[model samples]
Structures are given as C-alpha cells and as structure tokens.
Target: MAALQKKQSINCKVLVLGKSGVGKSYILLQYTAPPQEIVQMPKLTTVGVDYKYGTEKIEDTEVKMSIWDTAGQEKYRPIIQTYFKNSKAAILVFDLTDKQSLQDVRYWLREVKLQCGKDVAKILVGNKCDLPHEQPDQALIQEYCEEFQMEYIESSALQKINIQEIFVKLAKKIYQQHKASIPQNQLKQNSLPANEAQNQNSTSSNKQISLKNSKPKQKKENDGCC
Candidate 1:
C-alpha cells in the first residue's frame, strides 16, 4: 500500500466563460505569463475547453487554481457546462468593442448559476478595454452587476492593465469564501475555562499572603527555656 501525501495548499477551480473571440484565452495567457513574453501570441485560441494551471498566494496561504477557458460557440455550450461541475469561481468575459458580446454574457451567467449553483463567486470582465473608440455602456454594466450582486472590472490583456488585479481579487474572494465555509466553532483556537484564569490569580494571591504571614521561628530558643 502507498502512503497518502499530505496536503499543504488549497486547490480552486476557476472558469472563464464568454462568447467566441472575446479574448478569454488571451486573458488567461496574460495572467499566467508576462506581458512582454506573450505579446506576440495573438493567435492563441481554445477549442473546446482549455485548462491552465496557476498558483497564487493569498496572504500567507497558497492557492492552486485550474483555470478552464471554455469555447464560446453555441455548439460547445453543452460541453462547457460540464466543466462548471466543481468550479469555485468564474469570470464572464466580454469584448469592449462588441456590444453583443456583453449581452451574450447574461446567457452564460444563467448557465453558470444553473450548473455551478448560486454560491459560486462570479466576476464580470470587460476585456479589450484599451481598444480605441467603441466601448460597452458602463452604466448598463453597473446596473447588471448590481442586479446580480457580481463584481465587475475592466481589463486590457494587451496593455496588461488590471490583469494581475483580477486574479488577486478573485483569489481574495475565494479565500474569503473558504474561510466563511468553515464552522465558526472550528475557527476558534483553544480557550481557557471561564474560571481557570480567575482561579489561578486567586491561588497566586493566597500564596503571596501565606509568604507574607510566615514568621521566623523564635520557638526553638523558647523550647530551651521550657
């Protein structure tokens, strides 16, 4: 029989779902790599569902995440939902230049909720934010996010703007959720009994009084006189 390995870090699954050509793969690539290194890799694309592994430290604890970038085509929708099985967090990416892409995120959001349940943490990403000219309606996006109680942010994969912040934000939220899930009683460390501390103080005071009342033995000299 083989001995089981001890677990040191927590594992989290994060899903990136959006319409095709919304830079879902690009976001993951940029997040996992330096901007200068992956700058020329524009043609990178995920077919059905591509998995990327990355480790991030949330404060003192390390979190290993399997980031799943799902194909955004309608035909691949069924297959994409399967990857949502054990996802702890999800990012709904949309292209800033394409309004339809933003609107399509609603469908993906519904699918995520249905498949992954409502407890999964979700963040809305408006990618390609550095593009010139056209942009999604900020007010409308704010309304949607507020309505669904989802966090929203604008990111530019090419410019590397808010790229790292996205993951850090996600990691923080996931860590918080993990902490919240633990039983309250389990989170507290060992505590002394109600009277244990008070009793110790009382005992110390009695000891001091006993020492204070002790008198030098003069009885030995008096015994000789008896």
Candidate 2:
C-alpha cells in the first residue's frame, strides 16, 4: 500500500473584537508587519473591519491566518456579526487601564459566541501591559478566563511585549483543534479508492495465470491426438 500523504496547510480567519481604543488594530499591525505609515496612525477609531494576513508554523504545518479588526462602536456591532459568521478563531481584547473596557470584553465575547458558536476558538487579551500604572486586575482576568476555559495573555503593541507570542499561542491552539476535528473515517475515505484500483489490477493478473494454465492442458491433448 502507498504511504499516506502529508496534510496540506489550512487557511483560518481570526476576528479581533473589543471596545474602541483597546488596541485591536495595533495588535494586527504588529503581527503582520504592515507598512510603517499605516502603523503610525494616531489612535483613530476604525470605521470598518480591517484585514491582515499572517503565517505561523504549528506541528510542522503552516497555518495561514487572516486577521480581521472590527470596528467597536455600538452602531457597528450588528454589522460586525456578518464578519464573524465564518470565523475559525477570535481574539477578544480590552484595555488594562479601563475597567469599563474590561467589562466590555464580556459583550464582545457574547457577540462572537452568538454569531460564531461555542466551537469557535477564543483567546482573551489585555493590551497596554507595558504601562505599569494602567495594568488591569490580573487576578480578575485569570478568573474570567478560567470560567470560560479561554487562553489569556497580556501584550503591549507599542512596546512589542508578547505581541508575537499571542499569535503563536493562538495558532497552536487552532492547529491542535483542526487536527482533532477531522475524523479518521474521512481520511480513510480519501485514500480508499486508490487502494481499490490496486486490488482490481491484482485480480486481472490472477485471471491471466488461469488462462495460461488452461492453454497448456489443451496443447498437451492436441499433442497426444497427433
């Protein structure tokens, strides 16, 4: 039997949702290495969803991720649901300095769960970690993550602290889930037809052998009569 071929890389979409000024766009820009001019935008509100692409390796497979940064205004919330419909993963961000932003995280999480369903992978992020005075209550954040069974991390896009690690961890988690979600039967189904064709060839060879043996017996009979 031929060996199974390696699985192809998968493309995944990850949507970043949070309240305004929570640094969602910055996180995406840092991960994707967008043009310097774009990254230099002065803290402006995102009018609509912005898209970026990033790649990370997990378990010997390259995972190409499309990161979407959705606008956080209340008016834009309903429209953002459309983008979440086919999302494979999400990053829920909140500002460490603002307690209200932390509370808004729950709202964003609910929207994601409602639109993307519970099976969609999620990660919680607390941005602006480099600012000592603005740090959020880590204990509270940890408790929230524990309750939801979500991975949590703190990062500062300006300082570049844990910026890359966040993407790496999210990629790893999605890769693991993607591998597990594919059923063994489906993989077998993909390979079964090739094996069946090989068996058919073997059967044809056996029929040729039987025809050769029968011909020898006929030749011997003809020789005796002669």
Candidate 3:
C-alpha cells in the first residue's frame, strides 16, 4: 500500500467584536506579527470584516486561528452577524480608555450570543490599559462578568501586554469545549472497525500459513506411500 500523506489542518475562526476605535485591528496585527506596513494604524473605519490568520502550538496540538476583525459601526452590524455563524470563539474588546466603549461591551456580547448562541466561547478584553486615566473602572468590568458569567481580562495592545496570554487562554477554553462535545462511546465505536479489520487480516494470514504447511506434509506422505 502507498503511504498516506499527512492531513492539512483547518484554521479555527475567531471573531473580534467591539465598538469602533477599541483597538480590535491592532490586537490582531500584533498577534500575527505582520509587516510594519500592514500593522500600521489606520484612521479609517473597517467597512465589513478583515481577516488575519495566526498559528500557535499548545502542547502537541497546532492551533491555526483566523481572526475576523469586524466593523463596529451600527450600519455594519448586520454584515458582521453573517461571519459570526461559524465562529468557534470570540474576543469581545472594549476600550479601557473610553468609558462608553466599556459600557458598549454588553451590546457586543448580546450580538455574539444572538449570532453564535449563548454557549459560544468568549473572552472580555479591556484594551488600552496602559493609559488607565482614560479608562473605566475595573470594578465595573468585574461586576459585569459576575452578572453575565463571562471570562474577563485586561490588555494593552499598544504596549503588547497580555496579548499572547489572551489568545492562549482562548485556545485552551475552546479545546476544552471541543473535548467535552465529543462522546467517548462514539470514539470507541469509531476505533472498533479498524480493530476488526486488523483481526480479520491476521486470521487470514494464519490460515494461509497452515494451508502451506499441510500441503508440504501431504506431498511427503504421498512420496513415502509410492
């Protein structure tokens, strides 16, 4: 039999949703380590959604992530909803420097729940934490997480702080969810067919050896009788 080729892996899609000017694009660019030009800050708004792909290794698994940085304008909300349907996870970013953006986290979370369902994995990110004077109260974010039962974290995309940890935590959570969703019985059933095939092949091999040995003995007996 010809050797089988290694399978190419599919990237996981993670939607980055938040209000305008909350550093969603920056976070993505920083994580991907794109060229300086691509990472350059853009003053213009994202019309629809922009995609950035990144790969990280967690233990033995290689996780490829396609991050969708969605446009936060009210007009583009509907367009962004389409991408959320297949999203495996989400990073709900809010500007720590802007109190209103912090308040708008709830609205983004609601949209995520509506599009991706309530059980979708999510991480609440408080961006611009380096400039604390302009940010909102950390207590308020904690209160919201307590009320909604969501994971919360603080980060500064400009300073490149907690950027890697945020995604690592996200990957870990998604991995756990994926593991839980798979049934143990289904896994056992899937392995059974391969095991049966191997056993059948072994039995057939043994029978062929027995037949060859019996043929030699019968030939010798016929010669002796003659």
TM-score of each: 0.76, 0.76, 0.73
Count of backbone collisions within predicted model 2: 0
Task: Give the range of the ten consecutive residues with the poorest summed lDDT in model 1.
Answer: 186-195
lDDT scores in order: 0.81, 0.81, 0.77
TM-score, structure 1 vs. true: 0.76
- Give the C-alpha miss distance for residue 129 in model 2, angstroms: 0.9
Worst 10 residues of 2 by lDDT: 215-224
Q: What is the overall TM-score of model 2 with all chains considered together?
A: 0.76
Tens-digit per-residue lDDT, 187-211, candidate 3: 4543355556566668999999988
lDDT of 1 by residue, 25-81 (tens): 988988887656774766866778988888878865687889998898899877777
**Model 1 pairs whose backbones collide:** none
Candidate 3 has an lDDT of 0.77
Q: Decide which is better by TM-score, 2 or 3.
A: 2
Note the residue pairs that clash in candidate 3.
Answer: 96-135
> Of models 1 and 3, which has the larger TM-score?
1
Q: lDDT tens digits, residues 60-178, model 2?
A: 57988999989988999778888887898989898887789888888877777778787777789989987764557778788768766689988998877898998898888888888
